[model samples]
Target chain A: MIFLKFLLYVWMVLVLLGAFFYAPLAKGLGEYTRVMYFHVPMAWITTLTFLIGAIYSILYLRKKDIRYDYYSETANQLGLLFALLATITGSIWAKMSWGAFWNWDPRETSIFILLLIYAAYFALRSAIEQQDRKAALSAVYDILAFVTVPFFIFIVPRIYSSLHPDPLINTQGKVTMNGKMQLVFFNSLLAFTMVYFWMLKNKLEVIKLKMKLKQLES
Target chain B: MIKAYYIFRKDLLQEFKTRFAMNAILLFAVVTLSAVSFAIGTFTARQEVLSALLWIILFFSSMSGLSHIFVKEEEAKTADTLKLVASASAIFLGKFLFNIVLLFLLEIIVVPLFIALMNFNVQNYLLLFFTLFIGSFGLAGGGTMVAAIISKSGAKGALFTVLSFPILLPVLVSGISATKIASQEQGWMTAYSELQTLFAFSVVIITASILLFDFVWNE
Candidate 1:
């Protein structure tokens, strides 16, 4: 685990360096293209974490396991964090490229909706006082929220011609990135996903420890 | 399904008797419509803005009272009785249908008043009707399920809108776009994709709600 953590550290550092120095800047975008390496991966991790969160929520519902609730809750909170990062990073990039922090672009609107959906998740969790009831209701909510995600991320954004950059895999069915960019980009995705899972694992451990301490006190 | 219908009828009968949900939503719709038309008097707002305004009125009006289908059951302590009598899915379906009827009633009154008051011109009545109809299904589907979820929580009123808004956004977006097209175009083909989106959204939301209702209803 320690070795894996060390590797993650090196991998992220190398990806950052490659994003700046190794990857060739693209036409028109120049230095701003580097934001894609971090921003895109953060967005990818946001979706990935939310997907995992929903999956575990289904598991919790089926198995009636408190541990699964912990997993689902932790994954969801991390997903929200990464989503916030993705939005802030994308906003900075937007300000640079579009001359404003927000343009109400299709992509921006969808992510903002995702933020609201998960924020509602937390609000729902906070409102329910009982443990089991909170877990059950929230798991159901997570699943319902996940069902709408595809519409927001995939469908709604595509319904309008967007100010956001063409996706990595554009409508023309082309991978826009060249070789070194792809290498760095994929590595960044891998690094961030690894970091998310690592954080999820540690957070779950802390949750378990806290539960144990609560049980002892009781 | 029969039980579901019975549940729907029971709620509808109660609704007609008390008229709580109907009155709340109708009052909201009328007030909002009058305020909007009074504000934009004789301005001849653009088709796009008018279409968006219609949906905004419908959305907020539904938000005012749609959650009552579940919140009422919980508050009156009839939720437990309903649970004993009906399966979770049946209860959900019944409430879903009741909410749909309530939404339609709100639309019947508001849409006409909105048009008359704002002088809104809808070129394709069929397209506009289909958009509003399917959009109401989406709203009630999402609204019923969310109301069930939040009815279990301590804060019901505020949480219902917060929870349902994001879920219902696709419906609103597609509905507004379709209404915009309906205002300018003469055929359904022009707004084909928007109608398809509204249809798909309603199907997805309702199906997911039914499948997940067991958890929220029982627990």
Candidate 2:
């Protein structure tokens, strides 16, 4: 675990260096585009964690395992934290690129909706008292929320483009990029994804220890 | 399927006998309409604004009563008895059907009063009706599912709206756009895309709720 922690830090440092020094300035947006390195990855981790939560939710429902339920709840909690960060960072990027902090861009709206969905998840959790009942309900809710992510990601963007001019989307829904930039982007993405797993692992362990302690005391 | 109707019939019977859900839905609808009319008072509202307000009224009005469908069963302690008698899908369908009927009835009374009071003109009545019709199904599907999830939770009032908003947004977007087309009297093709989107959303939510209902209902 210590080795893994060391490796994650090393990876993160490499990504930072690559993002600032190695990655060439993207066209048009110049300095503003650098935000993409963090913004996109943060958004990715947000979606990934919620999806991870939903998968664990499904497993918990099927297996009736308290551990899986804990993982699901933890994943959603982390997902909400990452989603909020992404939204703030994204707003900053929007301010720089679009000359406004909030424009109701499809991407912005998608993240906002995602934030609400998970916020509701937390609210649902708090409102239920029974252990197994709360877990069951939240797990089902998690899966239901996950089902909408695809609609937001794909359909929302299409609605925007068809209804209005898309400032950010490139032709054919693909942004043309050379291999080097792709490498740096993917590198940062991988580094952040690793960071997510490490945090989640640590969170789970801490909670597990707390549960054991509670059991011993009781 | 037959069992589903039995649940539906049962809910309809109960709703009619007490007029409980109906009265709550209409009172809220009328109150909201009155407030909106007062707020927008004499402003020459745009068609989009008019379309949006109509849905806002419908949305909240539905929320007033729809959240109670399952909560009623749980509160009345009939959930367990119903659980024994009906399959999960039957209960889901029954509740969903009842919600749809409630929304339809709400629209019937509210939409006319909404247009008359707000002086909102509908150029394509057919399209407006279709949008509301499809939107109702989408709302019922998602709302009933959420009501079930939060039935035993403490904060039904807030959780239902908070949880419903995000999922309902896509529906509202399509509904607003479609309503705009209807108000503007745009050609059928103009509203087709939004119609398609609304239809797609309804299908996805209902199918998902059906498949997932067993776990939520049984647990």
TM-score for chain B of all predictions: 0.98, 0.97
Judge candidate 2 against the unseen true structure and give its global Cα lDDT, from 0 to 1.
0.86
The runs of at least 3 residues in candidate 1 whose Cα sits more than 4 Å from the true structure, single-residue gaps closed, are: A169-173
What's the distance in Å from true for residue B142, model 2? Answer: 0.8
Residue B140 miss distance in model 1 (angstroms): 0.7
Maximum-TM-score candidate: 1
Indicate which candidate wins on lDDT.
1
Residue B11 CA displacement from its true place in model 2, Å: 1.5
Docking quality (DockQ) of candidate 1 = 0.83
Poorest 10 consecutive residues of model 1 chain A by lDDT? A167-176
How high is the lDDT of residue B156 in model 1? 86
Candidate 2 Cα outliers beyond 4 Å, as residue runs: A162-175, A211-218
* TM-scores vs. true structure, each candidate: 0.97, 0.94
